[model samples]
Target: MPALVYLLVLMVIPLGLVIAYAFLTSGRFGGVQGPATLDNITRLFQPLYLEVLASSVVNAGLATFIAFLIGFPAALAITRLSLSWQTVALIAVVMPFWTNFLIRTYAWILLLNREGILSDGLALIGLGPIEVLYTREAVILGLTYAYIPLMVLPIYASLQRLDSMLLEAACNLGAGPWRRFRTILLPLTMPGIITGCLFVFIPSLGNFVIPELLGGGNSQMIGNLIRDQFLKSRDWPFGSALSLLVLALLVIIVMLQASAARRSRKWGA
Candidate 1:
């Protein structure tokens, strides 16, 4: 009962307010005022804002894919290690979280900037300076770096729970490594993969700081637009509408994750 009340007070109430604000008119100052209308919802369909949404999806998708490519191997490698070394490997995977996120992001800026370490190294190797900072690629890289650990943890948990005897059985039955992975391992670990992808994708879709600092504000995602609407433009109604869109997307993703998890359990059974 206490937890239910806590959720109502902290989550439900704020969400209800945001939904209400989305339909209302924006005040000349900053807050909502006047009769409710659908202008804010319609405004989101404009080509300019649609483009931002599209770019956010594409960038987030790319980051999720890249993180998976890196994280799956890392997770698998950790499972292969001895028990003591596995703990150390897991610690290394998550060590970045001990530092401030903003500081970590700033470190990337130092490395990717024109006169930074990357360019300096290129110069010594006789290669021309390649522009990386403030680009779409840089934003994607930053997203992948920041959230790859999220991908790794969930996958590692799934892998840890997996039965090694199943793989041994497959091997004894004459299945090769690739065949065992494709038939036994991949299917079993899919729930983790889905969870990991969603973890990376959702945050990447809404990330603003990485794009603002790393992409030099040239590449703006939906989160940046929402931030501008609330802070810079002071369009609370429109910002609330945009927030609703993101909330809706999150709900859908979560529903899909839940559905997949159920199916995975049934399949295991």
Candidate 2:
């Protein structure tokens, strides 16, 4: 009961207010004032905003894919370690979280900027001054870096829970490594993969800071658009509408994850 009340006070009330604001008219003074309307919703479908949404999805998707490519192998490697070493490896994976996020982001800026370490290294190789910072690629790289640990942890948990005997059985039955993995391991880990993808993709889609600093505003995303609407443009209604769109997307992703998890459980049974 206490937790329910807390959720109502913190999450439900705030979400309700945002939803209400999305349908209302923005006042000249920067708050909702007039009668409710669909102007904000209609505005979101404009080509300019739609393009932002599409780009955000694509960038986030790319980041999720890349993180999966890196994280799956990393997690698998960690699982192959002894228990003591596995703990150490997991610590290393999450060590970055101990530092301030903004500081870590600034470190990337130092490495990716024109006069940064990357350029300095390139100069020695006769390929100096690569323009990496403030581009779409940089943004994707930042997103992948920021969220790879999230991908790793879930997959690690899934892998840890997986039965080694199953793989041994497959091996005894004459299945090769790739075949064992494809036919047994991969299917069993689908829940974790879905969860990790959700963790990476959702945050990437709504991330504004990485794109703002890394992409130098060249890769504007839905989060940035919503922020500008509320803070810069004082268009709270439109911002709320955009927020709702993101919220809806997150809900769908979560629902899909839940559905996949259920199917996975049934398969395991």
The positional error of residue 114 in candidate 2, measured at the CA in angstroms, is: 1.2
lDDT of each model, Cα atoms only? 0.94, 0.93
Clashing pairs for predicted structure model 1, backbone only: 134-215
User: Candidate 2 lDDT, tens digit per residue, 167-248?
Assistant: 9999999999999989988889888988999999999999999999999968899999999998899989999999999999
Question: RMSD for each model, in Å, please?
Answer: 1.2, 1.2
Alpha-carbon TM-score of each model against the true structure: 0.96, 0.97
After the best TM-score superposition of candidate 2, give how far the Cα of residue 34 lies from its true spot, in angstroms: 1.5
TM-score of 2: 0.97
Residue pair clashes in candidate 2: none
Lowest summed lDDT across 10 adjacent residues in model 1 is found at 260-269
Candidate topping lDDT? 1
lDDT of 2: 0.93
lDDT of 1 by residue, 1-269 (tens): 99999999999999999999999998888999979899999998999998999899999999999999999999999999999999999999999999999999999999998899998899889884888999999999999999999999999999999999999999999999999999999889999999999999999999999999999868999999999999989999999999998888889989999999999999653
